[model samples]
Structure formats: structure tokens, C-alpha cells
Target: MTYLFNQPSAFAAELIEGFVAANADKVRQVRGGVVRSTRSKAGTVAIVVGGGSGHYPAFAGLVGQGLAHGAAMGNLFASPSAQQIYNVAVAANNGGGVLLGFGNYAGDVLHFGQACERLRADGIPCELLPVTDDISSASVSEIEKRRGVAGDLAVFKVASAAAEAGHNLAEVFRLAQHANQRTRSFGVAFSGCTLPGATHPLFEVEKGHMALGMGIHGEPGIKDTLVPRADVLAEIFVDNLLSELPAGVAAAKGQRVAAILNGLGSVKYEELFVVYRRVAQLLASAGVTVVEPEVGEFVTSFNMAGASLTLMWLDDTLETLWHAPANAPAYRKGSVIVAEALSPAEREEPVQETLPEASAVSQQSAQRVLLLLEAMAQQIQSSAEELGRIDAVAGDGDHGIGMERGVLGAVAKAREVAARGAGAGTLLCRAADAWADQAGGTSGALWGVALTAIGTALGDQQEPDASRVATGVRHAREGIMHFGKAQPGDKTMVDVLVPFSDHLSQAVAQGASLSDAWQQAATVAHDAAQATAQLLPKMGRARPLAEKSLGTPDAGAISLALIVNTVGSLLHDKTPV
Candidate 1:
């Protein structure tokens, strides 16, 4: 369990703060995460790798010379927001473009992909390298669906080495792709890890038993079996990875591989060495050569009693890149010539947005929007624990906390903009940006999209009518679907959002009042959310544990329903048109 934390919600932020302070010479703090304090060579592709916060050394620790240019850290087990990724990329960008690398999880894909598009739109060349190395997550036929695990280290190292060698963006991306293709990892957990301030761990394994193929984000393993001897466990890891050799590697024999025996969190180095001893014997017996094999924690889940093994089959180019010099906070390969530190002037600052002019009617509407945001914040704060419980059934169990952080940030931003006499549209847009920035996850990005869509539909110059509001809601639905790629039956928030938007639009078109229409739609949303309990998840982290989520409604769907119902009640009370 996490013993040192002031507040659970503030843990991720505080940890980043302390990490930057400790490694000030190596890395500097940025808006989202950390960037190399030293300047990079001109025209080198910036390698930005990231994921959730608990995996120390993986994200922030890897930001230094000859490694990642920066890392966009997220909430406990959540993906960083698009705004966060964009900010880091902008800070890290040199003359060359950016290469964003992360685990191939649903949230990471959604957030990082959005950031890539935004960077491209801004005329920055950007590419994505999602590491898919965990063989347990998906079958070989569906290799693209596999989740990234400790194997992220191999991909990050190779890509960053290529970038440091002054390779252009395209070449860096190609090398990273090659690294990802050659990597494979498998893990087992004796026990689960607890989040800060949580009374219980995310999941548990029975005593004397170990969970096979567990994830770094506190996800339970796919299967359970009695704990085996260290040599036997080593055999299991070697056997699984050898069973599926990457394309181009016709056989494990005569193949040179970079082997990493990673301790998830609490597993000691002594224990890992014992396992690696046998691991070495197995590889040697199989005629596979081990090169620079790492035997310690590289990517960890906060204090999880688990370990994983990764084997990256190395060709000539990969082997040379794998042996390249690297200097980071936690990872150091060899001697590197220290570069000059970035000057204070080179560091970027937050740009304050200028408020647009607003009419009196629109300004008054902003006040009503502020009230709605406040109510949503309160509702989320009250229901966060329950929402997290539901999500923990199959997901990472951070939904409630994520929503609380998002809604609170939105309310705060709305209040700030409304006090400046901003219009409803401007206020909502500002709030949307804040929600995405503060929350930093899939739901955060989706909610930000939804709010921005509504705000765009209702321009700042005019007061919104019932039809205009319905149109805005419909646009929100469309935007979420476009960005999230989840259909109604995917067991996501779309299940509730689509029905609510359809019903509200239909009612408004039939000349119903805004309040009445919203009330009716809220009922439909509530029913839709409840129906999610019977549907299996086809997206997100829950997909791997679909059966476990059979009796629980999606946390995203539930939160959307609750927020819309809260808004419906406010509308019914005649708070505003």
C-alpha cells in the first residue's frame, strides 16, 4: 500500500514535483511532465514517451540525454490528456518533428492519437509508436490488440537512440516500429498494488498462488495458478515468449536478444537475480544468445509484488542501437558527453488566453452554465468512490477520481471565465480545456471534446434557444463518437450519450420546451446506463476482462447519466433557458 500521500487526487502531481526537484540537473519540469534539461542536437527527432504515473523510471525517469526528450505523465493509471501531450511536444520539439511512444492501451491510443493530429495541424511533423509486446493480452493473429508491458523499455531505448543519432523523424519512427515488432513480454503477480489512500488493492491473488499475465496498471492477471519455483517461473516466461517469435525471427536458436527481467515494484533485485540465473541457462540451452540482459525494475506498478521478462530479438542494427549510450535519472547505459543546460529564457511559460467580447444576454447565460458546472462537480465528488468501484470490476479503477478531478477543474475554469464577463460559449470552451488538462485520461479527453462541441455550436454572440441547445448536444455526441470510436453497444459512454442526444433532438424538433425535453432525455440516459450492466465491453482496458464486467455498468456511462440528470433537474427548476 502507498504510505506517503497528502491526498489521493494530488498524488500524481506531487510525485512529479518531487521527481523534478530531485533530478533538476538531468530534467526540468514541464506543464505535463518533464523534459531533458540539456539541449539536443538540431534536427534530431524528439522522442517523447509516456503513460500512467505509477510506472517509475519508465516515463519521467527516462527523460534525459540519449533517451526521451520528454514524457507526458498522467494520473495514477490514466493516460495523459491531449493538451498535456501537445504541451510536452511543443516544449521538446527541435527543428525535427516529434515521435510519440506509449503503451498500446485504449486510453493512451485515444489521447496520444489526438495529440498527434493537433501537432500535425499546427505544422509540426508528428508520428505515433504504440508498443504492443504483451503476448498474453491477445492472440498472435490479433497481435495489434496486445497491450504493452515492460517491453516498452526496449522500444523506447531503440527509438531514442536512433533520434540521438540525428536520424530524421521518419527514420526514427521506422526504427521504433521495428523495435516494437521484435519485442515480447510476459509477467506474473503474487499480489496486487494499492493506489494512494485506497483501503484495498486493485485486485488480489490467493495466498500461495500467482496471477499470470498481469498488467502494469493494476489489472488482474488472465489466469491463476499455484506459485512455482524460481526456475520453473523462468521456464514459463522463456517458453511463452519463444512460442511466438516475431516475424523475421524464424527460430529462437542462434538469435541474439536483449533480455530484461523486470521487477514490477516490490520484488527485490536478489529475487530477480535468482530468476534470471535460470533464465540465462534456458536461453543458452536453446542456443539463443543474451545481450546486455537487464535484471531490475525498469517499468513498475507502484509496489506491485510482480515481475516480468522481456526479450527483444536483435538484428545487427537493433543490437548496435541497444548498446548505445544513455544517461537518465534511473537508466544509465554508458558514458555520455554532457550537453549545456537550457537557459531560463528557453523554458516555455503558460500563455494566458485573451477573452472575447460578449453581449449581456450571453454573459448572463454564462452564469447559468457556471451553476451547472458547479452542480456536476458536487455530484461527481459524491459519487466518485462508487464509480471507481464499478470501474475496478474490470477496468483500472480510476474513473471516479478522474471524473472528480475533471469536473472540479471545469467548474473552476467556468467560474474564472464567467467572472471575466465571458459568454457561455467562451466559458464552456475554457472549462473544456481545463478539464482535459487536469484530468488527463480517455474520459477527460472525451468530455473535453463534448464540451467544446457544445460551446462551438452556441456562439458567444447569441443566447442559446432549445433548438440550438439540442443541436449542440447532437454535435457533442458526434464529436465523441468521432474521437473515441466507440459505438452504442461498445459499453462506453456512447451507449448513454447517443440515446440522450437522439431523444433530446427529436423532442426539440417536435416543439417541446428545453427543460421538458432534457428531463425526458435524462430518463433515457439513466436507463441506457443501467442497460450497460448486461452488455460486455468491447473497448478500453475492460475488454481483456469482459466477463468480469458482466454485472457492472460502465463507469463512463454512469457518470454521463448522472451529470445529465443533474443538469435536467437544474433546467426543470427554471434556472435558465
Candidate 2:
């Protein structure tokens, strides 16, 4: 699909242009995208840097009061050259020297190395600091080659403090290097991303899968798998990150870190915390001290569906810099915590109201069906985080967690239903009821209605068939609309589900197996979800945000299409291995 979002060519220029225009009082652009402050003190070690674009506040966005002295801007996913780096360093070097810090990439090293040598020739003291924090993207043997992700901020902050304290360029450079050596990070992506002028995505996984350790420039990652829950993925990302650090090498060591949970883009704050809850616990268990954990978009790849965890072993100096007074457009060190309060007894962060246990079931056929359903439920349960990332595009972005909770609830209900010798329809309906009751959101209500309608249509007597399955979905759509009051044009999941069920019913009535009919249904749903981007959404929370959502398919509709597609795929293929 064509991206409605800003093209890097157009986007980068606009962003840098606006930043310079508004921050005029705080900074002055030197030759190349390198900007300098007119007020920077003479003989004060200067912090000069740049990287690929889209990670504002890292190389450019933070070039203001009490922060960096100069920033060399680059194009999207493209680093600035030696010329650009030289321009910034020459301007920023006022005898106290200049410390250059940037993400580690081959191009950056080549260019920054050239710039450093050039500055040295000019009698300007210069040292280079490259960030290597995303352990997810590299092997220990190849850590030096791994591209820096969100660790830019932590490492840079250390250098900035040294510079502000009037340390010679050498000392400042050493501190920045120290931060880079100790910091580590990891990321997970629900979907791939694209550059401004690109057509196809830079990387792609199955609709329901995630790419673990996906890098900044839409780089492919080490692992790809279905991820349905934010918390589960959070646990995985956190564990991987913790395992890489020296502090996590042993418990009771109590290593301290200032952590960052960064939203690449489009992933909202409301949804990000679900991941953070698990991450915090993982770090605590590893005996890593989290001095202050930040949760927001500090580094982004233009609405890419992912989050990265950055951990820095906070030495006393780094801790002071982290807590140092600072202000920038997207970040402020004094940023207030938006987290809700928790009493001692009220244990869970979100108070994860655990679902009831599955009931025992007897009938062999019923049990087999449940076994298959359980697989689908397990798949959903395992995919919560990725779902949230995809859903953030259009709907409320809670579909991942909501869908996961609903599936688990359905699993529990399925066991109880099967135990009572309930018909296929009856079991499905009971599961639907539990899903709706436990999962509090739109997806829950829609799936719940679908299951309930299917059960009623069956009336406790008939075996499920292609035609009846389609009929049940149709009835479910009707029920969903009645309660949700959402129309097909409203850019909701109904947009995809209604047409999907209709095609299923028509195809089945025309003679098709359950598998074939479902496959067709999923296909139509996929197309429909994509088509919702073209329609005007007139209802839901999306209506207000609809303008920004143009050209982006509804995440809820995408989820429906994905879940249905997976179910059909499961029915057609060998059972889950």
C-alpha cells in the first residue's frame, strides 16, 4: 500500500527545516546539517554528532540548552559524510576540543574517521565515540559492527555532561566511550517499515509474526515468529537484553541501569507500558538496578511497529548526567512519570486479573476440536505484543492484549463446554461469552458476538459446516454492529468482518469445504482491511485521529484478517507442531 506518511526525502527536510526555524534562538546551522549554538562557551569541550535520520533528539533534536553544542544532520537512514562531520566539529571546537559521538555503522566510521583526522590536522583535538548497544542485532564477536539504536541518548548524555563540565576533549571522549561499552539494547518488531521513496517494505514477516532485533533502517533481524502479547514479548526482549550485560551475569550483584523503552513510531504510550511492566520485573530479577526507566518515543523509524529496550550500567557520573537538568523537544530529563499509583497489596502493575483454569472435558471428538482450538488460542496468547504494535496504526492499539486475553478466556471456557457434552456451536458460544466478559474492548465484543451467534445458529444439535460457520459469522457481525454501533465505513473491524462472512456464506452455499470457505473468507477480509484505508471512518476513537490515519489500514481489521487467516491456514495444513 502507498504510504500516507512523510517521505524521507520530503520528511527529513521538513523536520530539519522546522527544527532550525523554531530553535533559531537556541541554535545556528553551520555548513552541512550541523547546527551550533551562538551561546556555546569558548574552550568548553563540545559534543558534536550525527546519524541516519528519523531518530530526532538523538543527533539533531537535542542540540539546545544544557545539551549538545552541535549536531550534524543526515538523510533518512543515511549518515552524514566527512564534510558534514568536519563542518560541525570545526565550528564546535573552541580550544577545549570536540568529542564526536554517533551510532556505529561502517559509513559513519569511515566518514567520522576522516573528519577526526581532518580536525586533528587543523590543530583541533578530536576523539570519536561510537555507540554499540543493540545486542539483539549482533553477536558478541560482531558487537562492534552492530548498529546503534536508542542507546544514542544515554551515551551522548554522558559526553554532554563532560563537555559542560569543561573536561578536555580527551576526557569527554573517554566518558562517552565508557557509556557505549557498558550500554546494551534489544528490539522487537510486529511489522516491517519503509523509507520515504520506497514502495515495498524493507523487510517483511508473516502478518501475525514479529522480527526480533530488527534494526533502525528496516534491517532484517535474527528471529521471526508469531507474537500476540506485549507482556510475553516484553519478557523475551528484556531477558535477552539482561543476559547480554555483565551485571546480569550474576544475581545479588545489584547492577544499576537507567533504562529506556523506546517507541519507534505509531506505537502509542498507552500500549507501550504493557511491555514495560514485564521488562521492569525481568530487570529486577536479574539484580539490575533501574535508576530511572523512560517510556516514550525517543528514537523512531517513522511509524514502524516496534519497541527497543536500552540499558545503561549507571555509574555515579552517568547517573548524575542522566538526572542532570535538561530539556529538548521530544525528551526532558525532568519528565514527570505518568504511571498510575499502586498500593503495596495491589500487586500487579495492570492488576492482571488472571483468568480461571480450564475445565476437564470427556468426549473424544469434543476434546480433539478443543485441542485444535487450544492451539489457535495458544498462538494468540503468545502474540500479544506484536498485535498491540500492529493495532496502534488505526484502532485503540489494545487489540493485541485484548485478543490475547479473549483467547485465553475462550480456552478456559472451551474446556468447560466440552466437559458438559455441549455441541460444537454450544462450546463456541460459551467460549465467546467468556471472551467477551473477560476481554474488555472492541475485538473482544466482536469475537464474542461471533462465537455466540454461531452457537445460537447451531441450536445445540448440528455439527459445524461450511454453510453454518458462514451463517454464524454473519449473525455475529449483526450482533457486533448492534452493540458496537460501528458501520463498515467507520474504519472498524466490521469493515473487514462483514464482507468476509458474506463471502464465506455465499461460497459455502455454492458448495465448498469448511477449509476452502474459510480461506476465501480470510482473503476477502485481508483485502477489505486494506480497503478500509480508502474509506472515511465515521465512528470510534479513530474518527478524530482519522486525518493522520489516512493511507494506513485499520489495525483492528488487520488483526481480524490475520486471526481468521491463521485459523484457516491451521485447518488446511498439518496441525501445530
lDDT of each: 0.91, 0.70
* Model 2 lDDT per residue over 1-577, tens place: 3265465336666777777778665565665464544455667887887876667656777775456777876555555655567777776666787788888764466556656876989888888888888886568986776778899888887788778667887788878888888788898787766656667665555798888887765555787888868788788877787667643235324778889998887678988898888888877776777887899887787657888888888778778877865554445676532223223333212332233233232133345557766876776766677767655654445567667767787889889867666656567767875665445344555676677787667554444556666777888888767756678788888899889988888888888877888888889998998897786666544554467678877777777777788778877883321
Root-mean-square deviation per candidate: 1.8, 25.0
Runs with alpha carbons beyond 4 Å of true place in candidate 1:
none
* Candidate 2 residue 514 C-alpha distance from true site, Å: 74
Tens-place lDDT digits, model 1, residues 247-363: 999988899999999999999999999999999999999999999999999999888898999999999999999999999999999889988988887765667768999989999
Write down the TM-score of every candidate: 0.96, 0.56
Error of 1 at 545 (Å): 3.5
Maximum-TM-score candidate: 1
